[model samples]
Target: MTVLTKPWIWSCVAAAVAYALILGLTSGRGAGELAYAALSFGAFAAIVGLGQMLVITLGPGNVDLSVPATMTLAATLALKAMGTDPGTAMLGLVIALFVGFGVGIANYALIYFLRLPPIIATLAASLVYQSLAIWSNRGLRIKPPSGLADFATGRFLGLPNVAWVGLFLAIVVWVVLERSVWGRWLLATGQNMRAARLAGVPVELVRALTYISVAVFSALTGYLLASFSGGAALNMGAEYLLMSIAVVVVGGSSIAGGNSNVPGVWGAALFMFLVVSMLNSYGAGAGVRNVLTGTIIIGIVIAASTRRVRA
Candidate 1:
């Protein structure tokens, strides 16, 4: 019943604090800026973690990808919306969500309907998304739209708007996944599709919908990123796909399926963000960042897998 009773939670907190301290000591960046960076990473990681939750908890075939594409497309759609009237912007969000959903549906159809492997289907879809983003951006950076740029830069009660959005999203997702009947069905389907189908759980539908949900979340994350970054560009979603998976795995979810821990996802995301930000502060290059991040994630996954094996 006590908070400290959870080893996973305590580990995440300790990791985050230690990361910040290390950065502060090594880079002379000051505790204040390091703290702010930690928050920023936490918010970003939350969105990424959500994507991981969707894929892992809702995957139909023990695999999920296309996260990066969905996010990039969503950010592009938001940018396009900014070029339109107020009414259009609203419509654009809807369209963006639809597009994201469509991506998911396509994945499902390819895997179940066409009998393609999940990895193949998702990888193909990811390529399509990457292609679309590259073509649209025309090798240019997504600039912040003048009208909506304020939302990204504006801070409310000391937190950036993106942070607030992340908070709201986390709460909403927590409620939906924990309180809804459909949520039970989702978990059931993820745990055992054949069993769920035998019990008349509409297995394929749930599986497809899971992908759709992930797509929607990815898109939403993209929208937030565009708003926060002042626009979107190519490969914007690439970094997140790996990070999201790492977060989920580190947070204690098996890549294969079953468990869904919302709070753990939050902690893992924060911890990851802190690690990356801390490394950045230490003047680590992107290559170094990738190496360190990947190493850490692999170690976590191995440890988790070992624990599962023992238990």
Candidate 2:
């Protein structure tokens, strides 16, 4: 299919148009400010969405339910590691990465060795991570470092640096998916795991690596979010779980795997943030927002699934 005809591309265009319309109708002259805020906040969702994209590309019925828990744990651990020393924040970053790796290992063991379904395995892992997060948060309160917070909230060249980070990550994933042999292997494995194994694709290894990559991305996102918000909370990452999946699905990544739309995920993330921001501006309550968001996601998922069936 031509790029223009790709469902993901069209979904992105539609999202942009919807955002513009919402701004014109609601914000008037303040649209730019709202847009900037949305993009800044949306960067976190976009980053997490990339991770979700990788995992979902592993095939049908695959998802990472541990994302929110991983994010929460990373944020809390980072705050603990960064205590009273801005220069030592690297320690926190490293710790977050390590935690993510450990989580990935656990997930791999559960799915690969225990032979659990991906969803059930990840769901169970998520509970363990959540418990860790809760345990870590107990009697621990630390301020995020000034430098990290500044970097997260600062503007470089009139754009949020976090947004730039998100863009860079997307580019890296795009290159891996489009220009590298590993990308080909990943797609092939997703398309037909048994066939890929027969063809010497190392299916198990690819799946394992994908899980690790997703965990690392989730950890990074958690750090950035904590820095942006100036502190970490037990529920800080709860919202991201659904948002990450929604962006990937809305961006045209196949639920059945074997395909991904990297650029589209970014647009979908921004669109989701805009919708939430607009609703907030209109004073919509949390319940209303949740219902609306859920309805929209369901619609998009149904449409994507239908298209896949038709194809």
Candidate 3:
């Protein structure tokens, strides 16, 4: 019971249960294979989810709707630049991060200067970013550099290399949020913007940095995903917009903000992958899978919210 109250725990439990059911149906076959697949695919969700978690932690109304577009644009540009080169992974990465930074700055400018709501600002910016992506490559699928592709698709120490990167990032984020002054300021800002400003928390700066961080995360994911998938596609990142938010929310981050769960985000990422696989094993179609996934996400979010209010 004590453990259950920890917001991150439930996601892990759900994942375990889903895996168990899937194995039961197959009479315990493919256990390792399923686990590997979940980690491999879930890494992207976890990376973006961590970024989204930070934005949401700044409170309600703060989110990046431009993630998919950012990913698409960054990947498109990075892949185009790298273009079958052998040692240009670093170049592609630099392009990706730069694109992310620019997008983040653009997002912040819209919110701060235009005084627009974050949702409206980001949603509007997404169109521009998407157009930029479409314009940059004109729907061409550019393959990543061979070395970059190998690193993205390769494994290490018995786990997917991408999963290792995700885990490392999760650790870094957890440390920053748990141990840094910036983390304190962010929490204060999220709890009450006016009060935090009164307390000299640099609320605006916090907001700016948070938005930038999320954009960078989205871009990095875009770069890696493009590499992993063999090329950059116009729609490679389309699925992750909702996925990033869902993982954050279902991981027990407070929807109203001021609270975050790094571990929960990763757990929720794994759960997302496992649940989909389980649904497929049970013969659920794509629509049914989506409906069930949405239902589960809503249920968990509601449960976490109610618990938070009660506590």
Candidate 4:
């Protein structure tokens, strides 16, 4: 079918297939439980993936490598700020968002003023961010406030609270990118920065804002994760660095830039988690899982690229 040709559709299909495979290995209500787990974990990936997709839409050679560091540092400071106070959820959230803002501005400043490539700037900044997190965390685990923890881990209408947050962000982002004037400017800028500038688009401002937005998104994920997991570990966001970019690419967002799809990101996020679960059920080792996952990603990229070429 024509619709099946959509790149994003594949992730959804894969997720379904993975779910079936897992179900085949078990009986009873395991299916529902597995699905719930997938949604709960996938939400984090989807949230960060949406942010990465925005920055990536800005064009090639543009990506935020500091997501994990941003997450770690923000969560560290936020948890520390709340200090397990009973009603300090908002305080912690604001602290986390503030940290994200600073990191975003710092990343852009490095790129704009120092003329550094995004990869280099974000990577360099990540080292500093990570150091800060280490110093602030001091190899200790700080618990999230009780209410915030419950809200993070709680469920709503048979779906995870975190999943609801992810869905909400996805909706907002989809609306902004698909319907707003600023979205048009972002797309135009991504398509051709020089042309966009000549046409009166504020390219510089767009870049700054995009960078900032990605960091803020990452920070939010970090805060929720710290709460959900009970504490923010120094390496809490390490795996998400790859997961963020992976979901973007797998969800049909163009790696080259100027194109994105939000539904695909969520689908891809679910698929990612399901695939790991399937592998685990089949007794695959971590190394084997990594190899297989990498292979799958490479194959998908090649297939997508060939299709684009044919089109």
Candidate 5:
């Protein structure tokens, strides 16, 4: 049976329901606000998950560690460029996209020419990016332009604007992965870069595009997070490193690549964000909370590998 017809998806759904039940039972203090928080975080997870799907599923043997740094940089730049001009926010967003693409190119160049491992290359790039972020502001916090704040803080259909952005991204990625030749090449390259190269698939180009695409998405996510929080901080992206990886891994994508679990991965992202949200709601402290979240992510990684081996 296909993974879609298997128990994993249902398991994710069950986990989500169980999470809701737990939240339901503990309702008393600001439950509504807590619920909104859960939903908002879940949306953010979805956006991060999309980036992961594109990266890992597009290049089976490769994975990126620069997601957090790229995101932080893009967001900070976007907020900085906005600079109190509401009308220029669009231009700022465009710049953020180019920034993301630039990061991707840097990674691709290192991996392709220097033959650096994806993880190592991304790690080095992340350090450099983080350093630049610090150097740019001298460790100062950067706020979104005043006029641009309303979009992040505003609600449509009683949901945060970020949710809308996530929904749009999901739709866009789904279409690209399911319908386009570029998407097909991504999957093909991930499944077997050697075979793809022999088939004249432009394997290097595809891989570079995948990294670039992921970087772009991560940048957007960071921008949203910063806007939501009212400012971008130097350390903001650090915490997201683990959370983003967890979302993708739990969503059913393998670290080794080959198989792509699009829907499952999306569900897993939501499942994880809900887990963190609930844990926080229950007054779990940061240390305990991260431990629990990390444990769950490790469990998922093992389970996913076991499933693949059994298959």
Candidate 6:
């Protein structure tokens, strides 16, 4: 496909233009500042969307519903472990990743061994992770390391360091999904699992590793978010679950699987965040904002379904 026909490129351009117009009409004084803020905040959603994209690409009806819980638990654990020591902070980050890895293993076992559907298995896993996060939060005081906080909030070339991290992750994921042998195997598996299996494509292992990779991504996002916010909270990752799925779908990824648009995920993330920002600038309440967001998501899903039918 030509560059201009790529959904990611157009979606990004549309988002940027729409954001500028909204800022000009509503606020009229801080377009640049608001743009920067939107991009910075949207980076978190983009990162999570990337993980969701990976899972969804596994096949139709596959999704990782445990992302929010994994992120929250990782953040809580990291905060408690850091406690003001630099060395301890790194160790804490590692420990949080390990926690997420453990959850991935559980998810794999439930789905692979029990023949459970991915959605139900992940939902059950989410409950476990959420319970653990809540239990960990009891009577705990959180103070994120100053160094980590600084890095998260710091700016380079007018963008936050967190945004840079998101960009780097996007590059990595794009390369893996578009330019590597593993990418071909994953696409083949998603396209036709039976065919892939017959061709010796290790479908089971690929699906299992996809879950683990998503968990790691979630854990990393949690750490970045906690550091950016200077602390952790139970609700920090709550909004991400729907947002990630929405971003992936709106970014032109096939709900049926076998196709992914890496850059489109980034654009869709920006678009969603910009919509929220614009509504807030217009003094819209949370209820109205959510309603609008939901409506947009429904529209996108319908469009995607229609496109698939036509194809």
Best model number under TM-score: 3
150-250, model 4: which lDDT tens digit per residue?
Answer: 99999999999999999999999999999998888888888889999999999999999999999999999999999999999999999999999999998
TM-score order of candidates, top first: 3, 4, 6, 2, 5, 1
TM-score of each: 0.85, 0.92, 0.97, 0.96, 0.88, 0.92
Q: Model 5, stretches more than 4 Å misplaced?
A: 1-11, 27-32, 59-61, 283-288, 298-311
lDDT of 1 by residue, 272-305 (tens): 8777766776779999998987787667566556
Q: Rank candidates, lDDT, best first.
A: 3, 4, 2, 6, 5, 1
Better candidate by TM-score, 2 or 3: 3
lDDT of each prediction vs. the true structure? 0.71, 0.84, 0.92, 0.91, 0.75, 0.84
Pairs that collide, model 4: none
TM-score of 6: 0.92
Which 10 residues in a row give candidate 2 its minimum summed lDDT? 1-10
lDDT of 5 at 252: 71
| Cα lDDT over the full model 6 | 0.84
Please identify model 4 stretches exceeding 4 Å from their true place: 303-311
For model 4 the local lDDT of residue 275 reads 90
For model 3, which pairs clash? none
